[model samples]
Target: MNQQALVDVAAVSAPCQGALHWVGMEQIALPLRVAGQTIAGRAAAGVNLVDPLARGIHMSRLYLALAGLDNQELSLVRVASVLETFLESHRELSNAAFLDLSGEALLNRPALISPLSGWKTYPFTLRCRRDEHGLQAILELTVGYSSTCPCSAALARQLIQQAFDERFTDTPVTHDGVREWLGGEQGIVATPHSQRSQAHLSIRLANGLDDLPLAAFVDRIESALGTALQTAVKRIDEQAFALANGQNLMFCEDAARRLHQALRGQAGIEGFRLRVVHAESLHAHDAVARSEWNWAGS
Candidate 1:
């Protein structure tokens, strides 16, 4: 059977010629290799329509450009190359390219005081822009940790002190007896409130880096927070975790400041902004604090 050939309208001239800043697809489902893990991701890929006389950009070309991500590990290098592919596919039609990939990355984490390990999922997004002049990439991810309110800790200590005074009003206070009392259930009459908190980090990476510093950043934040969420736990791990919480009490502002200071010392990051959200245990609303550094021009 013979069939008529369909005309390609996208190849024709526009009725009203006008340039478009960006022409592409958003939330395209894809599987990408990132940091040795295959992550299921959604990508937004596009380029500018520089040619005003052209009817439109070839959307299929932008879609095809995403195929490169499947083979290469997701990083600034991959982002730069894929963006270049987007512009090359629509050579005359585009001068600038943009790509955004969002997915969850899995990391295997060891328990604090046990010989067990488990996987933790971190939501991550990579965004990039490329043009004739230069290229830029940004990574955003979140870390979940525990935050014990400093004010709450102090109030709890005061209540314990009052309880101690009431219990031994007519007795002599000795260091051994006080230590015994602290080791007993009666010592901890009041406990401070702590809740699961999160730190969201957005960092601009230096150009031409070989790999994404995701693991390093996670380590940095977790170390600074000192009480990252664990997937598996034993009695020893729980006790160690309670000890860690006692040592690393912080407010939302402290969490933000710790991240800001730590990220500033990193080598591959040019700038960063961090938001710390403490899901308050004592109140109905969450406490949030934001900190940023070296992003004035960006």
Candidate 2:
């Protein structure tokens, strides 16, 4: 006699009720690729499963769908597509879905006046929403740069001038003499405070094109703000940094406005929100400014 094979299937439960909320599946890890580089990311997903009668949602499907993602094909487009898939898989229960991807993006930067190079990592985030209208994508990028306090720089200059005056009261001190005095043990009386700064930029894209040169954008921002952070520093690099700080002395407001201008002029950016935070070395609190651009026509 032939034995019958047993088949098992999950029992379908009743639908849930009005305005049910389902939130979980935080910190799901996956590999991603952006701007031609592969990076690891932990994506968080949440959705509102609204069924008038069901007891719970199918949580395992969300993890399985995210785990099935291919790192090589990971892009803004892919992310949005996956989010839609998540919504559709539970279309009967969920009316909207929200997905967020967080990870570190690395880049190689060359040192100033030196042949050496180093790597820099910036935190990146991308969020998407699936609703009745369609899909919307948002890109958030964080970049680090250096900022010199304008007040400190001015004070340093004043102190240097006073030192020169004190040294050459009887006779005018030559440039060499001033340089020597400033380079001596008591030469330059004071130095300005420069601190590592961070800029958080969030852009709303019209499409799912994640191919934007995020690293290059970061470089442009650092250069536009006039203070690219240094990984490996030598004497020359330090001098170069001092000069940069002196020239690009800016307050937190100025930095935010400058970043806003850059983002507004950048092509393919429909709209953007910029937040610049300068960690002040002189004080315990940080200075921050925020700016937003509205692209009505686009």
Candidate 3:
């Protein structure tokens, strides 16, 4: 059997001063698990090889170490450990290390009425870094939700009322007559537009620890938002979705504010950044708002 040859690339050159140095690899694929589910993700791994004299780092070691990770043992905690390993393995060349993982997390959710459930995929990013001071980690989650236009609902109500007043001026005003008028063409009005929305939430941990339950955090956000979009739906599920849409009417700003409040109230969150984007159905442009929890000063 022909064995793969190992090369030593950590050769040092002349030392330099007052320069920020970084050395590592990117787009390294690894098997990972969050909440007991196996997933394949790509991580951009790096470390601050501050040794001004070092030629480069052991890039192959980083890939080999990550490739040995097992699904059963993969978690945020494991990720942080791997980062530590990367730093320690290159101790001669660097004193700091960073790892970034990007991939989709699939979650199965039950429908409102139907007994069947479906999977929803969310984009997720996990990052960890270590330095002389300590370690820091961040979890980024992306969620998709539906937004309804409150203004349109109000306008629709007003148009129906106006149509009723005009059509029933000469005849007796009755519930059936009003319903018919509201359902007719004159009562049908151009509704204000609301669109499907998405939010990117990032939470920073106080320590370098990454033991938080990512899947559970995502579930909490999904539940707080009431309804999440799905890949597959039956008739019953569709009707239930319509009901949910009618009940939860929110503007772009309203959604952002709500998420801000929710994240602020969540336990174990030291710092957070929230960004909400609404793809408007009425206009060509999108509306976005961002909020960040300032922990450095406060």
Best lDDT goes to which candidate?
1
The Cα local distance difference test for each model comes to 0.88, 0.78, 0.75
Per-residue lDDT tens digits of candidate 1, residues 1-298?
8899988988788999999998889989999776678889999988888899999888888898788888467777777877888887888788999999999888889999899999998899988889886898889999999999889999999999998998788879999989998889998899999999999999998877868888888998899889999878899999999999999999898889888888988888999988999999999999999989877876
lDDT of 3 by residue, 105-156 (tens): 7778787777788777788887877788677777899999888888887887
Candidate 2's TM-score reads 0.86
Score residue 153 of candidate 1 by CA lDDT: 93
Q: Between which residue pairs do clashes occur in model 1?
A: none
Per-prediction TM-score, please? 0.94, 0.86, 0.86
Task: Compute the lDDT of residue 239 as modeled in candidate 1.
Answer: 92
RMSD of each: 1.7, 3.5, 3.4
Candidate numbers, best TM-score first, in rank order: 1, 3, 2
Clashes of each: 0, 9, 1
